[model samples]
Target: MSGNEKISELDKVLTQFNVFGRYHCLFMFWSFLALASNAVFCSNFVFSAEEVSYRCKDEGFGNDTCTNMANSTAECSEWTYEDPNSFVAEFGLACQDWKRTLVGTMHSFGYMVGLLLVGPMSDRLGRKLSIVITGMLGGVFGVARSFTSNYWLFIALEFLEGAIGDSCSPMFILTIEIVSSRNRLLFYILCSFGYPFGGVLVSLSAWKFTYWRTFLRVIYMPALLFFAYLFLIDESPRWLLIKGKKDKAIKIIEKAAEKNKIKIDKTLLEKMECEKEKSVNFFRLLKMTFESKIILKRFLICLVWWTTSTFVAYGLSINSVSLRGNKYVNYALTSLMDVPANFIILLSQNYFKRKAPLITSFLVGAFLCLAHPFLPANLSWLSLIMYMASKLMSSFYFTITYMFTSELFPTYTRNSMHALCSSLGRIGSIIAPQTPLLMHYWSGLPSLVFGSVSLIAGLITFLVPDTADNSLPDTVKQAEEIGKKGDLKKPAPDFVIDKDKDCSRL
Candidate 1:
């Protein structure tokens, strides 16, 4: 082809990306809902801590002494680290409050299970169906959680919420799949900002409605609305292309062209249409991820990063309510850090590489976690600053992980592989709540535990290849070939392969 022909070809591809219709908007809306879900669920940690403390005090079983551990029993109070047993002896129900901890862990476990299944299903059934199904399940469980009177029932419902509601990861894959390659990371960051932003909402809700059940209902309402709204959106064209649905994929591309006021290339459509039919199996996707040697290494590195981030991130977030300060003030202060963190993610993607930011953030989080415990009680200002630093790091890692995973995999396994990595992270979350209970036995345990985990997470991040400026891959062969050739060139414009080849790519 001539240079003019190539320029025209590139322009058409760019138009194909830019002119996406309601599906793009729908992706953002669901992202907001995913974030809102995280926020609402997280606020429960704060709300319950306060409620439990107040309940214990009113029963005359536990004293009103405010521990350095926030809403913990009097024996663990900053004014007197008299040992947890003394407080247990004073309060009958205080020690057995493992119900809250168990529920949180179960939720994470549920998320892990959901993550395992959702990604492959998205690849098989399409992003729109996976999202709608999970969103509906999440909404139903969220409301059910509000009505449960038994602790076991609440735990079961929380587990269900985690298991079914993780459509967030798949939704993330679909969102990035639709945007331009250059803006992919920024869009991921922007979409993810809703989680912490939802934290602010949770705080506002707690401030308005003191009861936890009422707050949960309020949090779930938006997800229910989002579910209703998602029905109008279409499936991802990229996913369609990979499924060998050439006609459907071209239709989406044409719609995008129409939306952008550009013309489609008849020849390119004709070329894609000539491809052979291909089938994608669940085992084939898994084999593509782990069966190969080079990509397998990449997969392991990605898994470690996700696990470390989830563990420390949830550990700090859930334990923040127990930190030494007013529950309301501490939560609100930490939640505010998410704004600047989101800003940094958006701006940094323009100027910096993905690996550097993620590694630096994890290391920073480690240091902050370590420092928080040693700081004297008199320096409340300094302590709060450390807490905010930890939060900022978590937020940074969370955004980058989504972008990084999406970029690393081929389009064929993109949704499933991303979901698989995320599912492992949820496993980390399942273990995170245990940190506080585990730390009670050791001195300055929360700090030591989180600090060590963050440090390890940062170091493990060094194992993955940097994918800054690379074109997104559409197939396992392309991704593996890139690694084999060591062609770390910034990714080229997305290829519009034939339909039959697209399935092989998927």
Candidate 2:
């Protein structure tokens, strides 16, 4: 058989097992739990580290309740927070604005480190093991974070939580690898929903528990549950196949077929041949990503879009605390926007493909964000509406970017590229918490920056190729070829397998 024919046969064999079976559903359940846990942990600080009404301690102050201290010139000798159990109250981070931002910054920095470490680890070790280890470690650290009394120890635990908790990428990659090509996009959309769902949980927890430590304990509880369930899931068959564990891969496929109630001839498994395993170190993956101009172009475009999406999405989310209203309602509404965002993507992905929706989302989100500063001071309601709209649109942009970037790369390098882009994207998140600080410079400066970057990213979205309905490429060379084809004007049809012919051959 020709090389192309061999690749086609492999794709056919892989998709033969029902992708939407009970097994796949079980996998997605575990994946969503992990994803949502990470999301809650990531956003929990928005509430936990919130600044509360504080006043300086002085002899003249009435029971640590100094009124009109906002205009006071006296240095705060000691601070008393409204919520005595809040991080600020416990750590005395009041008046030290940098420390407040550092709480989030450290988490993001750890997330970047996790991405860098976990990506290569996923490639070297199986995806399931990597997630299990990281998930358990993240859970441990998350629980530990609640027990820390020392400020620096809390910061270190937060860093560890970010490092271990942010293993969403590997779990995501595993979901993609396990499902059939036609069903991949649907699963991706479903998985992306977990993030906002997590955000909603965070808001609800904050509303229920006024104490930060208690809230931390609540959000981290899911991780422990997820860790127990991790043992029930199987390793990705594709990963096993690639690693030359043919017998193990065949058994997984057989089990999936059995669970899905499909009867297949055992002889068909004998036809499968493992490809020569390449040494896929980080440097080799990096070299492969940039060696082709088309791939390089796509990577650069995606990097910008991912970075901008994360920046705007996280910025708007974290900045909700500063909005003029009940912070709980503002946060819950912002997080709930993901529901419509996911619906819009699912509804529009077929008609708009990848680039159109992304561009439109970015443009709309940018307009709303940019218009925030110009709204009348008396029209706070309108300002809130604009902020919610911006959040919705940014959420839409963020969700689709994950799908788009996944489709742009070949299977072998997909996780590596995703990790790299996500790590780079963390720069935006790291900067997002500090954006509220920018309000000190100008009331609208942060919004202006977010809107401007999103606008530029929208323009760059035009350069990205559409991979709608296309089969995933198995090699880097094939990926380059797909990129060279540019925007797919016509949707590719799904791969169909000839069961009778395969059975006869077997």
Candidate 3:
């Protein structure tokens, strides 16, 4: 932590602006705004695409819900929906659970492709363009979706918006690049509240609007306004400096300082511009990984960990709305659980070794979920308690694993490896929507699968190396030697491309 080389030159200059920082707060607010909109955008299925209760007219069974019509041999051509305002109600998807859940699966498919294109585009084009373009298009598509009654068109829009419009990852990178190193964790923790806040906002909006089309248009209204971000915020000066746009980067810095009512010297900026990052070739990294025993073992293990984490985290989120209670309250509670999990991760960063907390959280959470189906029918409250507690545990390990994956890899290939694991991890989300369909097979089947995956993920943490207190490894040698008793060199750049974040977008 004492190494001067570990701090980037841009970070040093930005430290002056971090005090009495109006500019910092202003831009960070914009980032969270994107996050908020992104939350409601990704979670539309919780209300709109969920199965609604309905009764169909049949000669043998009169006014019985489709779920209650399980054993009846009668086919009902006409039906009455209890909600009158969900996708199921309009599309006649009452008896078809998989069709009801297909919207969520399609959305996840688009999100996976978006994550692939956005990161490199943010590097090549500017953050402002990425954020603004994606935001505007996402809104356009979302608003367009409101006018559609065809299920095929609705799902197509879902895919289009996801692939082209997700802006949160770019916004997240912009925030990290602009803020000083010391405040990164605090800034991230504060801004992270946006997702949960957005979830509550969605719940309230849906409750008030009561119609899927009305709710869809209402949330996307704010996204159309993101075009202002093009002029309102500065391009990340750090990125500009790295990309050799010194004059533009300097102008941004001077503008930031001027807005903060401070002065900066021109010579200082020029001096810092000379620092260069090592060029990374991803193809070479593949060769290096195969040559190192520990590195290869670590990468393979990360595949499992990342996949299981996404499966459990997102599966629980989807299940929250399906729980036997007020659906809004269930989702709000599950979303809010992430707030404490974020803070706990920040607090524990200095106090404990990372492995124990992660392992314990996954293991204990799995046990809670495993016990969810055994309680008596009268003890609904206890069952709810177990479900919520399990979600809390999932939040803990889910947040922690982002950092843990970064710590496990060598610097030159870290971003590439993280991206690979995350993309594959999308498989978990791809399958999560179908979990509700599992209930038709057995009531307890979904919970059993969630707990079983969590248990396997928890047990596998013992196989990979622990990275607490060790300097970040910049080479295969250092990565292989992680967790050994020694002071390793911090050879990588101070700034890392942070890939550990909400799987909702990236």
Candidate 4:
């Protein structure tokens, strides 16, 4: 067989192994850890910069103006914080609440900027190196931030950590790289379960360790485990082949085949090794995006959808810091919503078309958010239920955007476009921390903003083409013709994944 022909048979060769072989299990375990770490790294700000009740040193807590300075610190010569070890109290940041909000904004900014740099790094360097290196850096800087006495140093570490903390995406790419067409969704869901659990871990850790430093130590010290991944995890064979390192790719796959106790077709593998190298660069990604009108239009729409999803999703959890009930419980509940959301989304991918679920999640969430503040004090419990429900919807909306965005563009540009959309979407998370500031203007202002943007996004979602069980587009013309003519090209058997895999077993 020719190299091109052997390439199509690669899937056939891989399917000969058990679905949950030793090599696959090892990769999944590491990817799960990386994902959970990403979650904690991003959401730790809620506790690290948590609100602490404070009063002027001279003014007693009984004073009318000194009750709770969560929103406004009101100039003071000295202060008494309920938790001296809290983020604001530790730094003597008594008169400024903006500094507290800045923690999340700066970290998100770092993540946004880092997203652009890391995607290219993953492509040029390889997937496993990107995950291992970034994962290790996030752990090191995170631990350093916990020990720092300087506020500026803490803030700088926040940005540095966020910038390099984007290992989840690379981990995701690597997870799918090893799986065959039939089992990709199984791996995808398996890895994503780690994110929700990460939030629960952070909240539980913060609840146990009230002090900021202790809480951080409890959260980040374990991240040191990623350093071990360098020796433990294998490099991606597919990435190696594309980069013309066929011998290295072959060696990894041979090991995997052996661990799975499956014999390999040396003849077929030899032909694959002969395939020509295909290189991808950021310049090509940029050139292709700008060169196509349909993709450009969809890209703009995707920005709105992605921005709204991140804004509302992150806003709900960030705002949970100030909820009426148990802080840890509220935060955990909000974060935990992702569990059901993922399950529902997984079901949607199999049973429903993409557009309807995307639209309903946003619209229903908007309605719940819009109605939240209007409830009477007597019905506060009902409001809390609605809040959790809204989070569930936002979680579903956020995950589905990723799947839909990949289908909107051609095969060549799909990953790059998705990464671009995700990077730019961090803008929502960047601004989400300031909702506490919005609350000062009107307690309901944040909800109003979240609801309004989500409403607009749902309406805009109608314009997006539905990609139910359709084949992914392969060319610019085929991409533009979606929702009009049928698929211009069928998907290669290599990626014709079985979408109806049983979710119950997972």
Candidate 5:
């Protein structure tokens, strides 16, 4: 059938059962998995601060008991301080900051590459394929980090792990694409809360392991489980239609309708033989994402939001020296706060419109980040409080961004835009680790910078149209047309409307 007939059929089915009500559960389940997939990395923090030591003997020293001398200082007393990467250290390279940064940079670079491919690939091959490929690869690479003794191999595998694991971007696109418009924002926000919760899990696990390599190995096991579960999933109907696979789209829709106990029109099948399939080119995809006026506007706003959110969230986590009476205490406290952050967005979201919460949350984060630096160093508790508040606020905005972007573009462009935007967000994360190094040169500079970035992000939010009141866009042309009209709150274009009354569109 034609696109119009398909939409009409889908709408008819939607009317029988509240599209939002029946499908929200499915989307929520997928979102939970997405959270688990992304959080595995964050939860490794418990092992981040554990101390390790080595022993050695004195050669020509004054002490007669040369064998009693330790090779390295456990405290901050040594000049060299254990250069794990030095030729003498052998297996110690994993402990060095430069090595970690290099590994991290490589990981970020992989996301940069994955972003370009995964998004378009999702649009072309389907969200299910993209998720399975990336999630499975991530699982394989994530597990490999545990077995390697070679430093170079570990870095390479970790980089591959990052690239593959970051597939959550496409997964989010897929999850939101299948859900109704009404619950989209809430689902996005709630699903996003997984990042911090993942951090909590990492912290708990790493604390148990107390060694970075072992911690890395143990934390990412969930991805394998998630990969196994993907076979049970159905492709996005909207994506199916975009790819001209109307029959497959209808089959899934009918199955969903039957599963939900709703009926669909039998005649809809008669109208299925519709349009010629158009092959999408890479330049067109790139133009759709980067060059179009509509996409450029979305890209800029998303970039600002992603960069500021990442920098603020990570900066506070890294620089908040006052969060704990000690490091472990700080890890526990920060991890626990994620639970509230997750639920707060879940609760406050139904009561408020999307725009206000996002703007307010980000601004609040900026305030907390700024305040953290000025509080007296002696009053460390106050600093910790500020950091926690900042974290809560950052989490709120971060959740909103995902939902917002998922809805902003049409299925033809959603995965592409989401991936590129998320990739840019990783760029911000890569920039985040270096903030501490910058702060070492001038104390308080990092917070001030992060705070300023947050403020800017909050302000730029007004530039885009609010999605709190509309259905997701279903076509690139519709998105462009809507952008041209300069009305974000206008009723959705004809393309997104559902036509069939029975749940049989499956």
Candidate 6:
């Protein structure tokens, strides 16, 4: 057979293995576990260090009626918390309540550090290995955090957890790399389901365990299960091919084919070869990204969108403790909003295109959040409803941005751009915890700030090109031409086939 025919046959055989099947499903299940763990760790601090109603330890003050004690000369020294085991009560952070927010800020700071380090590390090592290392480290630190006797020790551990706890993004990239184009959106949604599922797990655990230390220990135990499951999986074939490990890549394909009960013809497999290209370092990638006006615009817009969405979503979530409702139930309800958010994105992604739904979600979410301050205090229920609605829309925007950003960049620099945007997004999260402090000045200041930023971000969404059904760009030049013709349904460029065939070139 001619070389072209042999290459064609190889492509067909690879597709047979790549079809959405048991292999992909299993991969997704494991990936979901990592994502769920991320969600749990990221939000668990909200409950662990939860603020509780407390009063002075003055002997004369009645436990039930401390309202009048504040006016008296009784010094407010020792305190009692509604949840005695909460970090605030245990560590006496009540008078110094500002320190409580730092628990989450430290974790986010660690995540920012991780993003800067891990993305490039994954490129040098392998995606699977990076996840395993980071996951195990995050789990270890998370477990050890429960044992810290001093507040500073606990804070230190939380920082480590934040740094290493970022396994979800790498695992996410791996799932994208392994799946077929047709299954990409479905796989992304499935993996994202873990965030809400983890939130549900957090709520259930908090309700059952009540004690902060035990809650931390129990929530982190799942990380071990996810780490163990990693052994049963293979590194991404796409990454292997990119590293010029053709034999190893084929073995993974063969294993998947065997598990999926498909036969791969040996002759066709022989024609498959990894095509190597000049290796681009992180610095070079950054240089190329900034040099291209199209990519730079998309990058900056996405950075802002990411920062805004994460800021609002996490700000609302952490700030829920201060809302006039049962904190646990409020958090769970907000977390559960992810389910409907996913469905909304799934329904609107194809029809609305990337830019429109994102803009709508941000604008609507902003309006609700901005209106929150104006509501009468008697209508606390109304404010709660608006907060939940804002969370739902922010969650939707967060989910869509993941896919939207992936579509905006070429495969060669996709991971780097994602990591950069995510790193910048962490700035929002880090700032979010501190926003609750604004309530001292005005109860609704945080909400107003979050909403206004989101409104501006939604307006900036117009600058990003719509990527509804467009093919993934394989080169910077192709990515630059994405929206030039102004047709949403423009047939994907001829590079689509090349992207699938020339994985190494990407």
Q: lDDT tens string, model 6, 419-489?
A: 77888788999998898789879988998998899899999898877775555554576578678774223
Ranking by lDDT: 2, 6, 4, 3, 1, 5
Off by over 4 Å in 6: 1-20, 59-77, 80-82, 263-277, 376-381, 485-506
Best by TM-score: 2
RMSD of each: 7.9, 5.1, 5.7, 4.3, 6.4, 5.8
lDDT of each: 0.67, 0.77, 0.72, 0.76, 0.63, 0.76
Query: What is the clash count of model 4?
Result: 0
lDDT value for model 2: 0.77
Model 4 C-alpha lDDT per residue in residues 356-391, reported as the tens digit of each score: 889999999899899888878788788789888989
- Steric clash pairs (candidate 2): none
Model 6: how large is the Cα RMSD against the reference? 5.8
| TM-score, prediction 5 | 0.80
Off by over 4 Å in 2: 1-7, 13-20, 59-74, 265-274, 485-506
Task: Tell me the tens digit of each residue's lDDT in model 3 across 87-112.
Answer: 78888786777787888888777877
Tell me the spans in candidate 1 whose CA falls farther than 4 Å from its real position. Answer: 1-30, 42-51, 54-94, 260-280, 483-488, 491-506
List the candidates' TM-scores in order. 0.82, 0.90, 0.83, 0.87, 0.80, 0.87
Better by lDDT, candidate 4 or 1: 4
Q: After aligning candidate 4 to the native by TM-score, how far in Å is the CA of 366 from where it should be?
A: 1.6
Q: Which stretches of candidate 5 lie over 4 Å from their true place?
A: 1-27, 42-96, 265-277, 288-291, 319-322, 326-329, 336-338, 346-352, 481-506
C-alpha RMSD in Å of predicted model 2 compared with the true structure: 5.1
What is the lDDT for 358 in model 4?
A: 92
Question: Please, what are the lDDT tens digits per residue for candidate 2 over residues 242-290?
Answer: 6788788778888887886777666667665534347766688678778
